[model samples]
Target: MTDDEAGAAPDVPQEPVTEPVTGAGAGPAEPAGPAPLGLVRTPTGHPGVDAHLERLADADHLAADGHVEVYEDVHRGLREALTALDAQPVPAPYENRS
Candidate 1:
């Protein structure tokens, strides 16, 4: 809450999400090569999402120097926030009738 950082955006984290482990070539790290994403940038039909997607698109260009890690670091807070906010409440166990 410093005077200079009053409205500064939260820093993202540097943790890669666990990728699916199907049979082969599936894990946390992306296989070394160009990503499958084809630089596709389209309107997400949502107001807030497009900016995020565009930022990701911009990030793709800088992935050579472990930019993905940088992204993970940067969006860590956002990811945690989303995960927490999206968590659903569990229901109580039903009791047997006497």
Candidate 2:
């Protein structure tokens, strides 16, 4: 084995099929028409949150795995942001007395 060849990174296996990610609640019985996210209030001002909702709304078109990965990526990032807030001190509320 040559020195350069032995130290090279290994090839990662990738699935040839471009399957879309779907929701975890979905199953083999619900392949045709996934399901609604059951969200009460959508179109929140937050871009990330709105994108996540849009992804969920379009989950039916996405492959089961793909939907899950996208969902996790969005929520995981939001979760990180939410958790980060706990570490920082909260600002005092403004008092208005007129």
Candidate 3:
């Protein structure tokens, strides 16, 4: 070895290390797509209410814009369920005659 190079560290080949690119030109860090949260929906016992709750799962696979439709449908269904409860005939003890 040459006297000037004698004390220098030996050169070793290295594999290139890569890292995820970020910032303005890096684009999105993850896909800008809908992903499921894997949430579980418990049964509400009431079929109408349960059905509406189940309908919410559809939004998990839909883009943000599509969620509004699912949300509105669930809302409308739940509202109908509530209204149906009000439409039911009252028990004998609760009925009033003038």
Candidate 4:
């Protein structure tokens, strides 16, 4: 091998490096916060059910570990609403006198 070719470095391909643009006229920087899941919650006709479902949104801003509390609260509320339905007193049938 020639002296020049022996001493030269190998020509390996490299990935291009990118840098964020800064200073005048750059678009607004992205927020350095957790992004919401953007899930849409449809409203249920029942207020109690709707409220419980809305409470689930609280988990969006929280870390994974914190989601349990929000989920548990929603679950408890929904369970209470269901239990309330069963606890309601049913009206007795009226007796008819001949």
Best by TM-score: 3
Kindly list the per-residue Cα lDDT of model 2 for residues 1-98, writing each as its tens digit.
97668897667797786445566643333445555556664587877666655665555566676687777777887787678768898889999999
Worst 10 residues of 3 by lDDT: 23-32
Q: Measured by TM-score, how close is model 3 to the native structure?
A: 0.63
Cα RMSDs, all models: 26.3, 17.1, 9.0, 6.2
Where model 1 places Cα greater than 4 Å from the true spot, the runs are 1-38, 73-98
lDDT for 83 in candidate 4 is 99
What C-alpha lDDT do the candidate models reach, one value each? 0.63, 0.67, 0.87, 0.87
lDDT of 3 by residue, 1-98 (tens): 79558886567788887666787666447657898989999997998799899999999999999999999999998998999999999877765679
Model 3: colliding residue pairs: none
Distance from true location, Cα of 84 in model 1, Å: 9.6
Write the number of the candidate with greater lDDT, choosing between 2 and 3: 3
Relative to the true structure, candidate 4 reaches a TM of 0.61
List, residue by residue over 1-98, the lDDT tens digit for candidate 4: 97668887666798886566666646566556655899999998999999999998889888777999999999999999999999999999999989
Worst 10 residues of 1 by lDDT: 46-55
- Put the candidates in lDDT order, highest first: 3, 4, 2, 1
Give the lDDT of residue 66 in candidate 3. 99
Q: For candidate 1, lDDT tens digit of each residue in 1-98?
A: 69558976577787886667866655555556646467677885754555555566555556477667646754774566467657967788999999
Which candidate ranks first by lDDT, i.e. highest? Answer: 3
Screening candidate 2 with a backbone cut-off below 3 angstroms (N, C-alpha, C), the clashing residue pairs are 20-63, 21-63, 21-65, 21-66, 21-67, 22-63, 22-64, 22-67
Comparing 1 and 4 on TM-score, the stronger one: 4
